[model samples]
Target: MSHQPDERQLSLNAFLHDTGHHEASWRHPESGAERIGDIAWFQDIARKVEAAKLDAVFLADGPAWWGTGHRPSNNFEPITLLTALATVTERIGLISTASTTFYEPFNLARLFASLDRISGGRAGWNIVTTFSEDAAYNFGLDGVPSHEERYARAQDFIDVVTKLWDSWEDDALVVDRESGDYVDTSKVHAIDHVGPYLKVRGPFSAPRTPQGRPVYVQAGSSNEGRAFAARNAEAIFTAHQTIEDARAFYDDIKSKARALGRNPDHVKVRPGISPFIADTTAEAEELSQYFNRLTVPAYGLTQLEKMAGTSLRHLELDERVPVEVFGGAGNVLDNNRSRRQVVANIVERDRPTLRELLHRLAGGRGHNVVAGTPVQVADTIQEWFEGGAADGFNVMPPLYPQLLDAFTGQVVPILQDRGLFRTEYAGTTLREHYGLPRPDSQYADEPALAVGT
Candidate 1:
């Protein structure tokens, strides 16, 4: 399976998590949980991913610890860690998740801009309206804001941030030692934005980045999330249980972008995939089962309760999961839609017992999980890309170093050989890597007629 010179190439991002994505990943013998706090460990992962020619390295984060304390949760601040990783890696994009609900637009914009500058234009922001109630409590809120309210705030927040990013024009800097004119005042303007969710008066402190601005990425998958992503996102991260479902989501989001007069191709859809790979399918399955055996069922049940927004601890482990807990497929939630559907899909499709359901979702939470030989894993990735289910994927390894090495060493070569993925770095900046155009500053140029006439 090979394509001609001009065929579309896939985009891949290595999602960085301590140890790996499986809930029990830290328990695996090969996983180095002791090195979780070491920046060198993350840098090594970034370097390896860059060597594979993947598009980027994504770090997921939130304000509060999310797990049941049975495993290590997110510790590193994404932007800070990516900034350090940027120092070691050159070509790979650095994407950091920052919550719209938690950060002030100006502050968040500055951090992303700083990262973009530090990384030499290889920066991206994964916009998220945080869903964790624990996170809300950390902010001293009485309760989590309603989903509608959060999205509304997010819209205003992004508007302000984008304006701040565009506050300085490309030619604003004129570092002439002769006349000592450091900046051109005419090219810089204050946004003076006053919105429902944010108030900012600015010209950003930072200058324009090489890509003009950091690439805008989104990760929510609800109806409102789809609308937001369609209107503004350059790339999106999502989760799905099957190829058909992923295709449905991809088509729907692209259609939405088209209806909004946005370039559909500019909005790349990347679903997360957690692969447990080995030389043989049986060995891969065994490897996966080993991780499942290490899983703490009480922790999994607690997590399920949080996802479903209902209690399940009383249910017998051997009995099938309660479908009514999800409010059925049609009634699936809009706030945490992806996870809700994952729970519902498990109940309706497999009708698995509570214990079985936990095992199934142990790797990726809600994303597709495949345990197979390297070729089998590559086959699934290729099928998803060619079949319109994904532009690529947020590759989540089940265990760090081991699975990451297997994928980059084994699976990526197959993709490169098939002409589905790139063998060498095509571009340096994140925007170029994603095939997105660098946006002209919103402050650029006057009307053609006004200028000429």
Candidate 2:
């Protein structure tokens, strides 16, 4: 008998930024930058996503400000910000970025565990190894650690954090009224992890959370990144400009996981998608162009400088970028290690002038930017899903409220009708939302099997 495909398996996440995905989204007349500091703004967005039953609302973070201070400099801290957001929304998953390189494993573990309990099991941790040298300076480091060193530290960080999370067994918490015992001491264990980069001593103060541990999400796509995620990540956020690239990444990662004795389906690969929608294809195209035109060339050039890791101050706005300027993107890919290859690929393929390149990078750094009517946008999403290129997507609106409203109002309903998206939330926790199992504590003892001699 042929196995039937699972129909209720599409996963969708809203990738929340200061204003939106477009670099110049804040400058859009309808967009609101006034409330970037307001919790209510994010709360309202989260509520809308919950109403649509999105799997999660993700927040990208960096330790230091990479952009010019002229716009909105990096504003809020993610963990504290998400804690506030959790109180206002009911069901949508909360995923926040925390760099493994910058934080202590025990503290990071405690924060996420607390968040999971506070949010009633709707927390997820987006694991990232810090990349920016600016971030290194902020952390009081002389220079950024090598990519290999960062990933090595990351592996140990995850190991220690997982140990901390597992320190308190599921049954460890026992509020015995008569005995006045809050916890069974025998059931709790300490993890004495002493790796090269981390030396964390456990049992954590927090008990086992609602989901055992927060769902682990990863975003890096380098070889080291892929290996790390294959070994540990439950869901992966990736960037891809084409179906072929997405498929290749998905297949490679899943295959790697299977080779490591993991269930490949457990590692969901979702790419970033920024869609500009309108009543018609022409109108949508015009809207996308309008956003591109609104982009400040100076701001774009500065961003390009950061990506190219060289000064572009002397270059004219309309001049062509030299092919040799990038220094071949080091072994692991330079600039932003995660995106340098992408930028290089774009430059090598298109050979566009500096002005044109600025426009191209304006839409969320090479993520697939689609401009079309609701039907067209939905068709593209459906195609990517059905074609096995993506499990779903990280929806990036070009601008807030207006862009999100357009997508949630117009495109979401179409997806719901087609059975490509959920009409109502079926699960309470982030793990459930992604169809991932709550990981059992590695410290738990297993019963021995009886066998005949």
Candidate 3:
């Protein structure tokens, strides 16, 4: 048997949150959360990621506000924001999360395809079934849909959207000035899609995008979520606090994809990692502690309340959390179901006091949090890549330009020196960065079919 090629050429993406990855990043003096309403700030971040030869810059979004006024909220819409970023950046992939449960397939397809075209084929769509009741309310619904139902709808939604994207052939447009023919009508086919959640008729208004359909990404880690990723996602964003968990998830998703008759290498698994790098290990640890100290206890309690699906108002900050609050073994918490489970699992396994739990979650939920020197940080990334745990990582720097600068200036060079990452961009588009193929239109054979059949 032939030996498998090395998978050490890891792909890295910058997971851009409002201010930074640390929950208290906005409170830090160096962060730029004050410019939350400015598009230029986001564009600057995108340019930085591109300069570093990163595969993509991802924007996490929710349809409605889940956190109270105590924490930084998602202020800008992702599609529009990414579109603006695309105009300035030449190489970085721009990915934005949009909820299948709350959006029409036709509109989403149009928006993402437009971005891909504008960016010359560097757009990606992160598919999610919105989990918040607030999001449901905003969408004119009384409550959020059941988990199984949401996945079912998502499957259908993706089918319709992709079909629409493929409705027009690449050469559908024929600009013949003498003949006064702007487009070849015969080449354009109508996708009369009628599904359980959507009914869209005819060809897409926009032409085929640069990469055909934007790279499909998924971030859920549940059973249904894993199945969905195996079937559809080219890239996956996961949250795991430990190497053991990351490796398990990586193996499980790839194995599932293989069983489904897909090349497992086609699916890239990346876990969220927030690195707080400093000149020295002690300095990094101090910085981590500083952020931890700045965390608002009231906000943490409120977040826990949401995660636990039960109120923690009566409990003191120093009190030990009872497993019974998580509804014991038989209890089901469905508020933010996945997050609730993550927090519950941590509480049950570690049995930390309420204060300790808050500290652990201060750095953007359960994403791996590390504070160290540049070399140590690079070592962590290398170990994870070489050990079959991740493709690369979703870099979530704890602060703004400072943290981002440290990673790019300090850690990136180390990665390049080890022959793990590129010093300069290899291609012009996000597809080039990720080594993904540009998709062919399903309607490319219209004229041939019309004549033969």
Candidate 4:
């Protein structure tokens, strides 16, 4: 595929993890697990990401520890870590996953607002609802809320947070030192929001943030999640194994956005890509296998059990898992969109062995994992970008620093040469970098606005 003179270049974000996305990445010799807790290591990586001119850097977080100590479960909190990262990186966006279920609207709003200001309009929030029972227990809840109930809470949670973000008009902070009149009280508004789940009162302490509000990013593929994202999310992070599914998801989300009377193009759809790069295709394929060889089957099975919500003790590791085995998640898969459906799709299509399934997942969880030369990797990206399967790809490296180096130092140059990605940043803010407009405040400029409540 070739880009026309006026055609747009796709976006790319660095989906960085403590070691990497691979389950055994920490065990890899090239991984930076030795300094995973050091802030300087992340800072250095952020600098490299900026030098590559990426759209953003994202970190996935959970309220409670993830997994049962199979890997590096204790990770630095995304918002907190990105706040420190903000001090070092100048142009790239800082996106973090925050749970709407665990944090109050007021506190979450302030955290993002502060980050946006400190980063000079580079903050993006990946909104999520806490689903783990362990997370719920930490918050003193008896049990996790039902899927519908948590989503209901998430809807109100987002509404409340945005209301607070928009409580102050763009021109509310008028620091007229001579007149001793520092604030325009008339311009400020108190978003007296009373929703089914939350109640918040009065104007926010801070003024309107840079980029109006940090770009609303969400990651969910379930029906309720799609509806919520269609109305609110400016960017979506989704997962899929094939181009057909990716295209279908892209169309579904965009169509939903259009039906909501929002511009579909404004909502960029990016699917995850876990790439293993080498000079030659053969070498790259072997590189993936090398990492797969390092995987711990016990850990993978435990994770698989979590994903399928059923024990797989009866199945042999080396044997190919029957399609009926995933009928195991029959009811569970219907409700949960991400986990159970991924490998089931693989089984129906390629029928990989049970151990092979673990190996594949050990790469990027459920993301598309490819091992090839930089040119081939760029070709894969271009085909998807041009064929309407994606607006961009979330670059998730299996073995970080080493794999990240290969992607940026090797693959990114190829993408730049093909005119598939940008070589230099053209904007200062995350919204601008994403080709999204800085939104008007909830009650600014426009006199009659239907604020969500």
Which of 1 and 3 is ahead in lDDT?
1
The global Cα lDDT (0 to 1) of model 3 is 0.83
Off by over 4 Å in 3: 1-8, 324-336, 446-453
Would you list the C-alpha lDDT of every candidate in the order shown? 0.88, 0.84, 0.83, 0.86
The digit string of per-residue lDDT tens for model 4 on 42-63 reads 8988998999999999988878
Clash counts per candidate, in order, are 0, 0, 0, 0
Per-model TM-score on C-alpha atoms: 0.96, 0.93, 0.92, 0.95
Q: Candidate 2 residues 1-453, lDDT tens each?
A: 112235646788999987888998888887779998887888888888888888899998998877585356657888888888799887889999999988988789888988898899999999999888889898899877888888899999999888889877788789999999988777677777899987866777878899999999999988888889999999999987778777878888899999999999899999999999999999999999999988988888888877777887887767877777765642322233657666666676677778888888898886888999998998889888888889989999999878888888999988877777777888899988898898887767732122111
Q: Cα deviation in Å at residue 356, candidate 1?
A: 1.0
Best by lDDT: 1
User: How much lDDT does candidate 1 score?
Assistant: 0.88
**Candidate with more favorable, higher lDDT: 1 or 4:** 1
TM-score of 1: 0.96
lDDT of 3 at 338: 54
Q: Which of the two, 2 or 4, has more TM-score?
A: 4
In angstroms, the error of model 4 at 29 is: 1.7
